[model samples]
Target chain A: MAQKKNIKNRATSKPSSLVWIMLILLIMGEFFLYAWSRVQCTRMGYEITREENKYKNQMNMRNNLQIELSRLKSPKRISLIAKTRLGLIRPAPKQTVIIR
Target chain B: MKFDNHKQISRRAAIIGIMFAGLFIMIGIRVIFLQTVQGPWLSKKAANQYEKSVIIRGKRGIIFDAAHREMAVSIQATSLAAYPGRIKNKNEAARKLSNILKIRFKNLRRKLETGRSFVWLKRQATPRQVQAVKALNLKGIGFIPEFNRFYPNKTLGAQVLGFSGIDGRGLEGLEFYYNAYLKGSERKIRVLTDALGRQFDTGQTNANGLGGNNIILTIDGNIQYITETALEEAAKKYNAESGIAIVMAPATGAILAMAHYPFFNPNAFNSFSRDRWRNRSITDSFEPGSTMKIFSAAAALDSGICDPNTIFYCENGEYRIGRNIIHDTKPHGWLSVQQIIKVSSNIGTVKVAEKVGGRSLYNLFKKFGFGNKTGVDCPGESTGSLSFYNKWSNIDKGTISFGQGVSVSALQLTSAAAAIANDGILMKPYLVQAITDQNGRLIQNFSPQKIHQVISARTARDLKRIMETVMTEGGTGVLAALEGYTVCGKTGTAQKVSTHGGYSKDKYIASFLGFAPAKKPEIVILVILDEPKKEHYGGIVAGPAFKKIAHQTLQYLNFTPLRQKKHQRVLAENEVSG
Candidate 1:
């Protein structure tokens, strides 16, 4: 009876030690994932900030170019160019046709 | 010996224990005081050291025409600045910068030598100048992006657009009127810094939040250009002091164009005087000569006082009213109301006003939107002087009938005429068509609003026919007649009020108010020329300009000419018969 009791105690001790080892491994894996994700998030934050600035600068540049185009296409400037450089003149009243 | 040693050691232990208790009590008191008394203050100080704040100016809104063409735009420009503390060789820096920026060398050197940590070298530097400065790459020099207001059309609609100062504050015109909506809000961004005062990256946030809303005006760019070119020519040709031309959609009271002579470029507004910047269409009032007859006729006809054929003897061109004799440009007898308006007879108009009486006439003028604000979406509109009927003398009544004693702004006169063209329903004039956000989403839309019905449809129709006669062969405004379209118009040649209190014989204001396609009018135009030389008559000076603007506007609007429509109808009839 004494020998049987000692064998059961040893058997329970072996499984309990394996369970403890698995728990320790799982915890280590979680910690490693958390640290790696934090590093990636920080790097991406810098990248997004730099990209946002580039986008803003590009938008401003496009707006400036559009303004330049509008200035060039202004009616007064067009008329001046037409009259002086292109030597164009307005048509007489009869020259224009009216379609009903 | 052992007993004496024990007593000495016990005494030493007691002394050290007392000293340790005192130190613990002092440390506890200090910790409590620091945690409670100075906590808030010290935390704020620490935050100030570790945080960085940057002020980003909001971008101003752009102004557009009806067709979404840019009238005024804001462009990003670089402003040059300096850190005076970091600047070395201040004299050299100033000399080099002044040459590039065209600033005074001594003044710039003095600014750079100041004790201030930062100083503005130039606000809104040109791209060329910015590039030149950047090439120098001088120490302590910095460049910051700023928005600068730019008018693409230069002087095309200077008075309407107004201008913004270097600091982006609206100074005049629509810019001043809609300043609250046009000027943008400022933003402050706070960043977290580490222990050594280095900022940590905050993920991409919209750098430009909500900016000021943009405005789209009711003005058509092409129509405005046409009107401006024509008015400029008329002013230059006649050698007039100044001139104004207004084109309005009679039905909706939408002012398609409002132009004034002697225009100035908004980009260089400082070089022009204050007078040149005034929008004379609404800001300036003048005695509208015979243009008042049209309103007087409406009052008489609407009140059942007279018919189109009611006859009145002209007194052979002279009429005496309360110690004053009013003279006509020419003598006429037995003239009907229709004929009177065709000739613009002063005696005939006075007699008609007498029949309508002063009370009715005053009410008529008030109802026509004179002597009051037209409530146009423009700044500095004048409420023209209209004395009460009780205050009118006999001479005042007679002269007011012929548009001498009463004064009116060009906008009021044109709007009133537009009411008549719109079958007597007065519409409040508006310029801004819509307000939009930075992303081009519509925030608010302004539609046409009818102020009130000023006259009956029957009365407006009768007046249109009578005014049509005034543009016919024998009328004073014959020059205003269009070949392919029917025109209803009135002419006015008022002697300008002299500075000394009487009418000036040499100076006259020549004006014409008219609308085309008399049966169903689309547009009403008003042209006024001040102190036109050689010819003082409205028919000669302003009548032809009225014709040109009307014809061009009708063509631009694609209104089918009367002949073309009639011919098309005939062809359709023949096709059906075959």
Candidate 2:
């Protein structure tokens, strides 16, 4: 009777198929997470590079615009336009009245 | 028989195995030789074939006026370029590009047909041209980004600000003087490329830690414009060869505006002559003529040997020293020290100089910064010509007393006059007011620098009073007088020095140096006209210009006339009551 009981316990000690299935699924999940993170890192690197280039281009455009604006507001240009287009003339000292 | 056959086979197998092992040993030796000796050389050669580096230029700094208006700035521009080897249909490309770039078709075609890999279509193209070229989108044509210097105010302060060349190097004026501070740093990018010559990795390294610094000058744009227009008109009206007007703050020695006629537009500086590029105020020296009388009077007063009431004999407009005879414009009898200056009598000035003695006069000249550079932060300054006291003969002393033998730059004359206006203290003249870094952080700030005390405050006050008489009704510089404000000034009519070492009778330099509201001075202005055809007198030619500049400048500064002061107060009181 004792020998028969020990044989019965040994027969029941092998792992079930369901346990094997869970181990395979966990390994596949780890591989998927690793692939996702790698893809995310590569994508972020490209985005950062694009943004840096955009920033540089914007700065160039801003500097160009500033030069243009300053040129338009120059004294000679303003005075010329005032005389020709606006028909303006410099006021004489007698004509101007200081409030204070 | 079986045993013999088996032994023979074993011997043959052993010999073959030994030969195979020897071949393996030879191969291992060759591997070690290649790894140890040729590995580094081969790898470097490969890297040389695929690696690339490019230089990134930092932006050049901006130049600003005292009011923070942009006088000069560096702007980003695109230059059209081409890889000739890659360009197919060269004629068609050239024809289309020439139309857009406004270049000749033949020239563009020749450039595109060159054997070289790269060629420039245009450097620093206009924006409209660049846009037009971009619209074509031709193959092998590309654009290179570059920095171009732009002067928005055109000819305003051209000589003072100078100009940078297309290559961004400063070539003249303040641009050349402060180049090291105004030039920007550069960056280098080292790229690692693959076998196909495509870049795979890059390391960006800055060559310098800091960018260029911006310069804020003491020049005021409005005042500069005013001075320039007034000087231009004076030059034209007088039919003069050229003109210079310098406006300065007397107390601080800060130059507000330095105007030059025959002004060149820095944007098109090349279209003008190189002579126009000179900043004549500091670069050229000439006889001060009677402008030196004010200094002579200062010497006499400061020496304690004479006062404004001191008397001297004029020798009836003719005085002989050695073999040289000096003549005044008009004959005069005995005149007071104040009267000598008021009439600008040459004979009177010589008699006073004799009383002061030669060594004392030379010392006075030295104290007034004659024969020396003012050390203003400008390029091409002349030290002027003043002989040593030991070299002075009686004739030299007499001629120099009337401002003929000695010479000085307009800048030096202005600085000396400014000392009187600043209560006898001479300040070092400077154009740059402050230096700022790229991020607008102040790196250095310049303030008023007092160099020496040229005269006593009492002497300066006395000299001011005497100079004021120069603009009175009977004086020479009456044209320089403002209606309500007192103008203390001296007029100069100097004969031009000929190349043969003699004076030209026909040519003269007319100049007026003065400051307004004499009691409490604000601005000292100098106007000099070279070779006025219509008028040869300083009081008649340059004095009116001085008055105009002072009046406009005073009005711009809101310095009310003494008559206007009471009127303004009453108006204010009335407004408040209403």
Candidate 3:
């Protein structure tokens, strides 16, 4: 009778399909969470890069404008214009007054 | 049996643990190597792969007058640039900008289509135009903050103040002289921003960021204005080709006002020509005519070679020296050296020069700061011309005796004249009073620096007395008299040298060098008018201008004569110096 009972218990110990399904689900869940966070991180990084590029471009334009402004103000250029364009002359003491 | 088994197990366990400890040590050593030596290299490699750095620029400094008035300043401006690759609608952007900024739309469109990453749509746009562009909110269109120089005073003291470039650096005058002290320290910062574009503090920080310094000039704005105004009026009234005026403190050498005609506004620098932009006070050189006699006379007095009572036998107004006949406007038989200077007698000054000798006169000229730079801190300064004594020609010496055959800048002439006003002490001509940092700490200070006492106090006093006589009825001193004020001055009508070596026939530089209250002068004024169309005589063309200007200046400074009571003195009391 004991030998017959041992044979019956061994027959009932085969692996169930439900255990395999549960293990697959756990691995898939972790992978999905990792993928989602990675997408979020990449998006954040892209935004920062874009903002930096924008600032860089703005600064370059500013530099160019500053150069233009200075070029316009050079003494040589102004003097050229004043002498050729405007009919002006130096002042004289006889014409102007001197006060203490 | 269990105890024996336990002892064997413990011994085996200890042996295995020692092997594990060695493995752990090996891994720890690897980590130390990676962190200590290779970390920087790896980090740099990583940065090279992903990071890009661009240099940031510093803003230039603003310009201000002595009165703390903004002569030039930075205003927020925008530039329109295009990302050629990103520009999907070049025509649209150009049209929009042209409409908003009033730019040449066709030109801008052509620039945008050049297939470059960046094309400037506009530079230095006004605030309204920038706002207009921003309102459009167009994509790929951008603006950068920039500063532009503005001149609020227009053409006032334009040459003296000079013009700045886009970088806001001084190119001339006070601007160039104090450039180093004006340019401030620069700084850089690594910044972090949040999603809302607000500035966020980063643990990483940097210093070395700085703004420009401020310069406090010795020029008084009101004085400059009045001086310039009077100069303008005189130039117009006299129908003169060019004119220059300067007001300075006799003792301190502090330049209060320097006025020149044909000045150009720094903002509109391009609108004028270079010839009109120089400060004549320092740049232009001419024979000072009678003004030169004052120096010669002072030299004779200081060296005890001649005194006020010294008399010279005049050859009835015409004298011959070394095959050259020198003539005076009026011939007097006998005259004292003092009377000669008082009358501005060319023949008389020549006689005095003969007795003093040429070398003595030249040495005196050097002592009086002629033929040398005034040591003024201005660029383009020309040291007046003094032919070497060793190289002197007899004719040159004779001509130089009466203010010819040599040249002196307006600065040199005026400064020498100032010596007499300041009791014979020559002072350095200073334009900038002080230089301060951004926080207003003084970096430089200019005080009353005396070059030397070129003449004794008594000599100066005597020269003053002689100059006083020139303004009186006895001399060519009719036009330069200031009513109610004791005026002493000299009149000069120098024949301008022709480029061909002789004097120009019609062209003359008429000038008057004068100071007030002969006993104790508070101000010294030198006026020069080149090629006057009306009266060419220094006393007539340059003199009346002196009277008018001096009158206005005295009122401006609240100056009153020493002997005359305020408002009680008659106009006759102020007679023209002879």
Which numbered prediction scores highest in DockQ against the true structure? 1
lDDT of 3 by residue, B1-578 (tens): 99999999998998899889988998899889989989999887865554433234444455545665444444445666667677678788788888887879888888888867787776777778888888988777767655565655667778888776655577766667767766545545445544554433342222224556777777766667667776787788878888988877787887877888756777778788888778878988988888788888887888899999899887898888778888888888888988988778888888888888889999989988888999987888999799987777776776797789899998888888898899999999988777666556777777778999888899999998888888878788778987667888999999888988878988899998887766677777888888888778899887877776676666667665443453234443554331
TM-score of chain A of each: 0.76, 0.75, 0.54
Best by TM-score: 1
**lDDT (Cα, tens digit) per residue for candidate 2, span B1-578:** 99999999998898888888888888888888778888899878877887777677877889999989889888888888999988889999999988888899999999998898999899999989998888888889878888888888889999999999988888889988888888888777766555654444232523234457899999998889889988988899999999999999999999999999989998888999999998999999989899999998899999999999999999998988887788998999999999999999999999999999999999988998999999999999999999998999888888898789899999999999999999999999999999999887899999999999999999999999999999988999999998757889999999998987889989999999999889989999999999999999999999999988898888888777766676778988999999
Each candidate's clash count: 0, 0, 37
Task: Give a tens-digit lDDT track for model 2, residues A4-92.
Answer: 99998777765555577788998999999999998886566556555666776787788768878877877777878999999998655
Which runs in model 1 stand beyond 4 Å of their true positions?
A1-43, A81-100, B1-50, B192-201, B574-578
TM-score of the candidate numbered 1?
0.87
Q: What is each predicted model's overall lDDT from 0 to 1?
A: 0.89, 0.88, 0.76
In terms of docking quality, how is candidate 1 classified? acceptable
Per-model TM-score, in order, reads 0.87, 0.86, 0.75
What's the residue-level lDDT of B245 in candidate 3? 84
Q: Give candidate 2 misplaced runs (Cα > 4 Å).
A: A1-42, A80-100, B1-51, B88-99, B102-117, B136-139, B191-210, B568-578
Which structure is stronger by lDDT: 1 or 3?
1
Q: Which candidate leads in lDDT?
A: 1
Docking class of 3: incorrect
Ranking of all predicted structures according to lDDT, beginning with the best and ending with the worst: 1, 2, 3
Q: Chain B vs. true chain B: TM-score for each candidate?
A: 0.91, 0.88, 0.85
In terms of lDDT, the poorest run of 10 residues in model 2 chain B is: B199-208
